[model samples]
Target: MLEKIKNNFNTQTWVLIPIAIAINIAIGQLVLVLKLPVFLDSIGTVLVAVLCGPWAGALTGALSNTIWGIAIDPSAFPWWPVAAMIGYMAGRMAQWGFFKSWWKVVVTGFVVAITAAIVSTPIAVYLFGGITASGSSFITAYLLQTGQGIWSAVVSTSFLTEPVDKITTAMLAFAIVQGLPRRTIGGYPKPEQVEVEGGEGEGGANNTQMYIAIGVVVLLVLFAAFMLRNILGG
Candidate 1:
């Protein structure tokens, strides 16, 4: 099974990789059409993670949204990789069969959100957090203020939004992957290519080009989101 997967990676990555990346970016833009509170594009990141595993997911997630951050929230630019990688890890965990049930998926979603928050909170606080009286406001305004440092503000803000983003994204990814027709990643597999004699390796997980494709996708989506958000005042 591993051998087959590796072969798939060796062969079609160059071609399918770019296409997948494009699809992911376009999907991210399309998610904007829904205007959900959570970022639905995380679904794409998760899907990549689940199918191709962590590396692709991480690469794709970090890249696409990192650019998005730079373009959209300039102050939050550093967080793009943080968000994408979190999504990548979450999706990878799910694909490892961590989210077999609906409730499990929800829990996984929350887990991802919290994980993202934990990973990103400190960086946000140290970098751009001192922006307004936001941190001090937490100390004075919010009742349960432990303190007001980079950690507090980052954790607080992330706690507010990361869970929502994670849950929504995980749920969405679960549904999409479940619904997708089980075939090769590229599409209906060629009749010439029979299912190898082993357990299901990631349908097209072997494709290395897939990563390149995902990377391209990440860049394009970030660019698009950056431009679109600016235009729409999002």
Candidate 2:
């Protein structure tokens, strides 16, 4: 794991981060205005999770959400990390093949969506309500405009959104990995020893590098979309 961590920060990975940040910001803002059901923000988190597992996912998630939280309200400090954690968990689950099948994806979606709603709604209510004692006004306006109780609206949104976000994220991550160079993914599957023996090791580092580079690139794309939305537009 430590070795993997060391490798994850290779020159290529470092280059990708800032570029990804810029792209995510742009995309995130555009999507918000377009009111797309799919969110590009969580893709970086998902890629991190897929490539480096949950820890990487957590970092990606937190950063992405923090940027977004600042846009929503400066007082939403507490909620950012929480939301990021949720993003991390979703990515981790997807990595575990939670979305391997359509049925599985549907089931995973239901579970994640509900959990996001339960965890996220109250925080939103609190934050939107002026962060004061009488949060009643904030809650009232939210509910009135939606024509549903705040809880219902939030919960429904969560249920509907989580699946769309997770599935798309998972699919994108998979596609990026497939498209990347081979060494980038796993060091070439032992190409050196494969001298007619098998393509087991050595020589294929280049392929692995490509896979890694591609994965890193995908992560950046996600980050750029998110950053654009939170900073430039917001």
Candidate 3:
């Protein structure tokens, strides 16, 4: 187990973790400021997960939340576990070859969304009474006002919001990986995890997959915007 953990980190992984953390914080802060229902914070975490390995990914997530909480938003402090699990699950999915194609990345995002919802439910219910600082708290608030229990409300809110956010994050991460040069990707611990199908390790296939991922990301963003408008309008 120790060796496995050790193998996940190299000079590139170490360097990437800090950059990934910054990405998480910057994008997260922007989303929070916009009061959007979706949290597009974990794009960096997913990026590290696919390029490095699970342990490295998990570490990036924990650190991302910790710093964000301390420096940006205190409410973010308690949710590190959810972020960590997102990283771990993404890495595991990639290891299972889910990151090799656009469709598989969507599945990975859904699974990660479920994992995040399950992990965060207890935190949201116990720590913040299902109404935290996130814009998605509006959904929980609306649900609770409708007489749903706190646990049910929070979980339902998460299930509704997390999928599109996570799916978009995963797709963006995949697209970024696809855009990276082959030699650069080779420096990572798990470059093979991102080798696109049909190209068999060549750049041509990855370019096509990356374009598809970007298109899907744009569509998800529009869908999220629509959902946000409805949630906020109601």
Top-TM-score candidate index = 3
Each candidate: RMSD: 12.1, 11.5, 3.2
Please give each candidate's TM-score: 0.60, 0.54, 0.85
Q: What is the lDDT of every predicted structure here?
A: 0.54, 0.50, 0.86
Residue-wise lDDT of candidate 2 within 80-141, one digit each (tens)? 56546655565456556653333343344445545555776687566663222323234334
Q: Write the per-residue lDDT of candidate 1 for residues 1-234, one digit (tens) a residue.
A: 565334323233334334544555676667668765445556666665655555555665676565566555444456566756665566456555655544556667767877787877556556655333333233222322434554555565566656655766666665665556655644422212222222456443233533543444345346545643453352
Q: Clashing residue pairs in candidate 1, if any? A: 9-206, 9-207, 13-209, 17-209, 17-213, 64-218
Model 2 spans with C-alpha error above 4 angstroms:
1-23, 30-35, 68-78, 99-111, 130-150, 187-234
Using lDDT as the measure, what is the rank order of every candidate, best first?
Answer: 3, 1, 2
By TM-score, rank the candidates, best first: 3, 1, 2
CA lDDT for candidate 3: 0.86
The residue-by-residue lDDT of candidate 3 on 1-234, one tens digit each, is: 999889999999999999999998888778879986567899999999989999999999999999988998787899999999999999999999999788788889889999999999999888887889877788889888878888888987787778888987888787788889999999999999998876355543455665776676668667767875776577
RMSD of 3: 3.2
* Each prediction's number of clashing residue pairs: 6, 39, 0
The regions of model 3 sitting more than 4 angstroms off are 30-37, 199-234
